[model samples]
Target chain A: MLRYLAKKLITLVALLFFVSITVFAVLFVLPGDPAQIILGINATPEALAALRADLGLDKSFWGQYREWVGNLLAGRSHHSIHYKMPVFDLIVDSLAVTGPMALMAMGFAVLISLPLGIYAARNQNRHGDVTVMFFTQLGLATPEFWFGILLILLLSVQLGWFSAGGFPGWAADPIGAFKALLLPAFALGVIRAAILTRLTRSSMLEVLREDYVRTARAKGLRERSVIYVHALRNALIPVLTIMGLQLGQLLAGAIIIENVYFLPGLGRLVFNAIGQRDLPVVRDIVLFMAAAVVVVNFVIDVAYAYVDPRIKIN
Target chain B: MNTPLLGIEELSVGFDTPEGKARAVDRVSFALERGETLGVVGESGCGKSVTALSILGLVPSPPGVIESGAIRFENSDLIGSPPEALRRIRGRDIAMIFQEPMTSLNPVLPIGRQVAEPLMVHRGLNRKEALDQAAQWLERVKIPDARRRMGDYPHHLSGGMRQRVMIAMAMVCRPKLLIADEPTTALDVTIQAQILALMVGLKQEMGMSLLLITHNLGVVAQMAARVVVMYAGQVVEEAVVSELFGRPFHPYTRGLLRSMPDPAGRPDGGSRRLSEIPGIVPAITEAIVGCKFAGRCPHAFGRCREQAPGLFDIAGGQRARCWLSRFPERRRTDA
Candidate 1:
């Protein structure tokens, strides 16, 4: 296990390096001048040149990339032109919203999917299964942002159940913070639950038919034990695989939903940074997103190994 | 006769498919006496496993339903019993092992935990106590270093060892009946013999009735006192093991016997092509009006094709479902 962890850690570093390169390369190819944008459009060429030199934008692409990476590692980092703070600190603030919202969305999804999926699977072909399936189909068909908008309209606008959008600082009022994010989190969570419910249902359906489940039943185990204990664990392996992939998706998917909710998440930060042409913030935020994806996938692999001992990490 | 431990009467199981309801076990009836081994022998898809699965009420529904039946165990009706009632009887009063040991046990669970599950569920033992008892079961099944081996997953065990674990699990509750559905089919020949031996030993030691379901005639010959032969969905014949082997009255039974490879070399000393039953078992969905084995039976007469024969007593505690068996009435008169 230690060897597996060490191997994963090494890959994580290499993956981060690759992600940094991709982010840098894409930004390098974009037709814009970061220094000029940071300075004003009416700024003199001398001022622009001095800003470029100060920012090290005049250096070769590879040379600039190495120095940027080295500085990031060495604790010397670039500041966001728009935010007027270090890029690292700017991203941390963005993540503060993104992390909680994503987790709450996923937490809600799992809460809904696990029971709904298991219930649907157990009552296969009955009204319970059909109804859940029909709702899931509707959930799957609706775009997450559209779903969020519909949620906002129904819950916040119509019923006044929750605030429409925006993140209240968690430290301010914990109850209010949760209530504020609830609608968006639910909006994000419902669509995921739709996909995950179907996944869990089918996976559970297959596991329910396995011989061990039969053996479990033969042992006169209660229906609950047979379904939840024996069948669910085996079914969970596949569901968990998708769940890992889905977590990363929820983060990326938060981009659109964040816009819809007016939430000050990384997605919004990236949107604003790109519009302002704050090269450092955009690059840093996107790099963080990429790193997040890599890290999520690594955690998933570790989790899969823990759930299913058959998985041997090389 | 002593009261049968389990009496299955007119039990027919059918699975609903897109096409229609396909009957898998058609009005199959059998009685298992206490401490007696009953071998149910048939080819693949002949409903051998389904019969065993139905006994536990473990056949997955929506697709499967007991069309009509009575499964009486300990004076209680098991068929259409409440889920709680069935669950109480299952794994407690009766336990079952399956055909494929490779997939029969939970892969993620420790072999010990799986073996101990029955004890925990039925015996009301705590986790620590149940697991300790599970180690004893493993040791009983002759798993070496049973205590230390408790933590290893199913993947760590060999095929035969896994089957032994399965047997251990089934017998852990000291169930009145242990239904082993082709438990040794997935193992090598030597391992198959060992598993069979182990099961028989466990059955005798536990004083449990054994329902050994297998397609192998030799396996039946070795382990069973009475043999019930099923073809397609019907019970084609039933007799004492020696009597069934000595004189198989049904043509399908005769075909099965002929198909068995000769353990002792033929006089010519060269391997001969083994005789096959000639035709595949009819698919259950196809509406067949006659004997399921007629197309495969060489002696299938006009009556065999036009209608199915009911089980007929062929004298001396043997019975066969065949038109030929009916002729014995006139033969006895002529004699």
Candidate 2:
């Protein structure tokens, strides 16, 4: 198992390297001037040249690439021309809002969908099954931004249960921050829960038909225990696969929902950085998203080993 | 032998398909006495397994239902019993083990949990106590290092060992009746003998009645006291194991016996071709007015095609469903 994890770790590093290079190449070719965006029209040529040199914007393409790589390896971050702060600190601040929201959305998805899916599969073709399927279909159909707007309208605008948008700092007041993030988290979570429930239902249908489930019933286990303990645990490998993919999607897909809720997040930072031609932040954050996906996939592979002992990691 | 432990009266289990109702088990009736092993024998699709499933209340319902029947166990009718009542009886008064040992257990759960399930359910023992008792049961089933092996998953054990674990799980609660459906069909030849021996040994040790269902006549001879011979969803004949082997009354039973190639019976002391029953076990999707096995019975006659034969007693608790065994004057008898 250790050897398998070590191999995956090496692959993850290689993949991150490839992703960083791709992000750098794509950003380099885009038509933009960071110095121009930072200095504005009133700046003199001398001031602009000094600013360009200081920012490393005046270096050759390869020279700038080498400097970025060196700074990354040495644990230093270039100053963000847009934020006027260290890029690391800015990225971390944005993620503080985005990370919890994504995790909360994920927890909501698992808690809601796992049972819904299993219940639908068990009831299968009855009224309960049809109702759950109908809602999941509707959830899958609606867009995340539209869902977010709908939640804002219902909870924030109409009910006045929550403020309309913008995050209060978590460190300032944990409860208020949770309340502020709830609507947006639920909004992002609905579509994922819909997709996950469908996957869970189908996967559960297959596992429920397995011979082992019959034996479980023959043991006189309660129908509920048979479905949840025996059937659900076996059905998890496939559901977990879909969940791991959805997590990376949540992290990257946060941009639109974050925009809708006015929640400060990394996706938004990357979006604004792209328009401002802030090279360091854009490249780093994109790399981070790809790394997030790769890391999540690796963790999922390990989880598979736990769910099914028959799976040999090697 | 006088008082029966389980009695199935005119049980008809069918499935609803697009075309019509598919009668998988047609009006099957039989009885098993206390501490007796009654073997239900037939070809692969002959409804032997269905009968067992129906008794255990495990058959899938929408497509499958008990069209008509009564299953009397311990003075209570199990056929239409409430789920709560059935749940209480199942694995406490009665328990079942299936054919595929390798697949009949949860692959993820530890073996200890699977063995202790019945004890926890029926006995209401706590997890730790149940597990301790489960370890002892595993030891009785001859699993080495029983306590330590409790942590192993189903996939970690060999097929024979898995079957032994399945047996351990089935017997943990000391059920009054134990139904084993083709329990040894999927094992190595030598391992088959050992598992069958272990089952018989366990039955004797616990003094519990056993319903041993198998297609193998050889297996029935070793494990069963009396045997019910089924053909195309109906019981064609039933007798003491020796009586059925010595003199098979129905043509179907005769064909089943002839199909087995005996080395001692070979002509000129050399190998010879084994006789086979000509036709497969046919399905019952449409209405039937005559004997279901008449098409495959070599001695099928004019009356055999016109009406189903009733089970008639020949002697000493022996019964065969055939017109040829009855007097030529006998007619219109139905069971």
Task: Identify the leading candidate in terms of lDDT.
Answer: 2
TM-score for chain A, candidates 1 onward in order: 0.94, 0.95
lDDT per residue as tens, model 1, A1-314: 78877887888788878888988898888888987787778999999999889888889998889888888899876888877889878777777778888889899999999999999998998999999999999989989998888888998899998888877778888888778778888888889999999999999999988888878888888778888889998999989888888788667537888899888888888988888888888877777777788788988887888788788776
Residue-level lDDT of model 1, residues B151-182, one tens digit each, is 98999999999988988888888889989898
Task: Write out the backbone clash pairs for model 1.
Answer: A218-B91, A219-B91, A220-B90, A220-B91
Where model 1 places Cα greater than 4 Å from the true spot, the runs are: A158-161, A172-174, A251-253, B266-273, B328-335
- The whole-model lDDT of each prediction reads 0.86, 0.88
lDDT of 2 by residue, B1-335 (tens): 35589999899999898888888898899999999999999989788899999988988877889989899997789998998888888788888989999899999999999999989888999999999999999999999899999999998899999999999999999999999999999999899999998998999999999999999999999889999999878999999999999977888898888888785866677776788878776667857677877787666678888988899897898898888766544432230
Extract clashing residue pairs from model 2.
none
Once superposed on the true structure, which residue ranges of model 2 sit more than 4 Å away at CA? A41-54, A312-314, B265-267, B327-335
Q: After superposition, how far is residue B155 of candidate 1 from its true place, in Å?
A: 0.1
Compute DockQ for each candidate against the true complex. Answer: 0.83, 0.79
